[model samples]
Target: MMDIEKLQLHPAYRVVSDDLRQRIVRGEIQPGEPLPTESDLASRFGVHRSTIREGLRQLEQDGLVRRQGKKLLVAVPRNSDLASAAERALRMHQVTFGDVWQVASALEPLCAELAAQRITEAELAALALNIEQTAAHVAHGRSVVASTIEFQSLVAEATRNQALQLARAPVSLLMRAGYAAIAPALPQSGERLLEAHRHVFEALRQHDVEAAVGWTRKHLLDYRRGCEFAGLDLDLPIPLAMPADGPPK
Candidate 1:
């Protein structure tokens, strides 16, 4: 017979959260639905109320539950929030600019291609506004890096595929870490970014899949070239620092 393995007991709070999280994921608990009272949960789980509270806190941080006044409601993790979590994980792992770009190049052109078919007028207007702001930033000699990154976010949102939107968000966040560092050495980058964004926006407006994808690919290539031009080592890890609250809005 095989020897019995040593028991490694997990925390009670983790056990509680794990059980509750499964229930929420399995749809037994639903979005906008209030969780049971803490006292009730403690009784059900045969744990102290403090234990239950700790467990619930984990769920809150996981974005599986939210507070509505005194009630805890089940919630879906927004793509943006999920992306922030992913960005943090990436930072901890010392993800490189090349790592980000490799994934982004795969996702971004596809995002624009999908948006050409699925984009809404509001999203188109958003992209237009981004380009407008980018142009202004360029004219005023202000950094356009953030606006360029935001334009990518807007394009990803326009795709309306939650999976794609969430997947691309963190990549965009990582790109910002590099963009801010490279901008000073590449003064013409802002105008180049504005031109690329405008071209893609027009393609999206005309529902031109090829042009949209083409311009997006060119734009991605431009980024790699910019990094090279700036003498940046693509292998260098992006800065681990993020905004205090999370990735920039």
Candidate 2:
């Protein structure tokens, strides 16, 4: 029996996003379908246009909708850039990078521990592949923060826990933004970051749960130290308008 009270719903938009999301998930809406316009949604929901917009924004942040020029189309799931987009929205609401780090500290190490115990060979290989890709990014002088997130995401998937997956869904937005902010702080972070990941990956490969958890903790703490060293105040609310293009680290 399902727990009715535990059913998820968006707080601000509630039924609107819930119903739409359900349709999308259940295959009623189908992928690549264009969503109705705001006016149409407003009429269907019997709410003001503002309510529809809010719901759309939430969906957009969740990687469920895409904006093509001015048209809002139903997006394919798990957008590569949705994490960045969602983080931007949260910053708009004055959510800070510190808030994100706190959540990462709480959840990610446990994710690593579980992955050590439960990860399959295929998942482990996927993690290794992500690391290899990150190495290429580093070689090209690109910041590997996005690649790092992808690697961590593979860890989460290796856990094979749907609840964990759902729990992580929203927090991923903050992580993407925090990564952008922190990438510039470390000098030649690629080698250091890659080594750290190698340690964590090897631990998982050997099913060393304690080592995986410990390495994950050290990695996250090290990242926090870098942010602090860069004079970014984690305690203060992060401003939304972070400059996207900065001098390469």
Clashes of each: 0, 0
Candidate No. with top TM-score: 1
Which regions of candidate 1 are displaced past 4 Å?
1-7, 242-249
Candidate 1 on 1-249: residue-level lDDT in tens?
A: 999999999999999999999999999988999999999999999999999999999999989999989999999987778888999899889888899989999999999999999999999899888888989999999988678878999888888898888888988978886676557778888888888888999999999999999999999898888887877788987767856223222
Clashes of 2: 0
Q: State every prediction's TM-score relative to the real structure.
A: 0.90, 0.67
Model 2 Cα lDDT, one tens digit per residue, 71-90: 78786766346455655667
| Best model number under lDDT | 1
Model 2 CA deviation exceeding 4 Å by range:
1-89, 241-249
Worst 10 residues of 1 by lDDT: 240-249
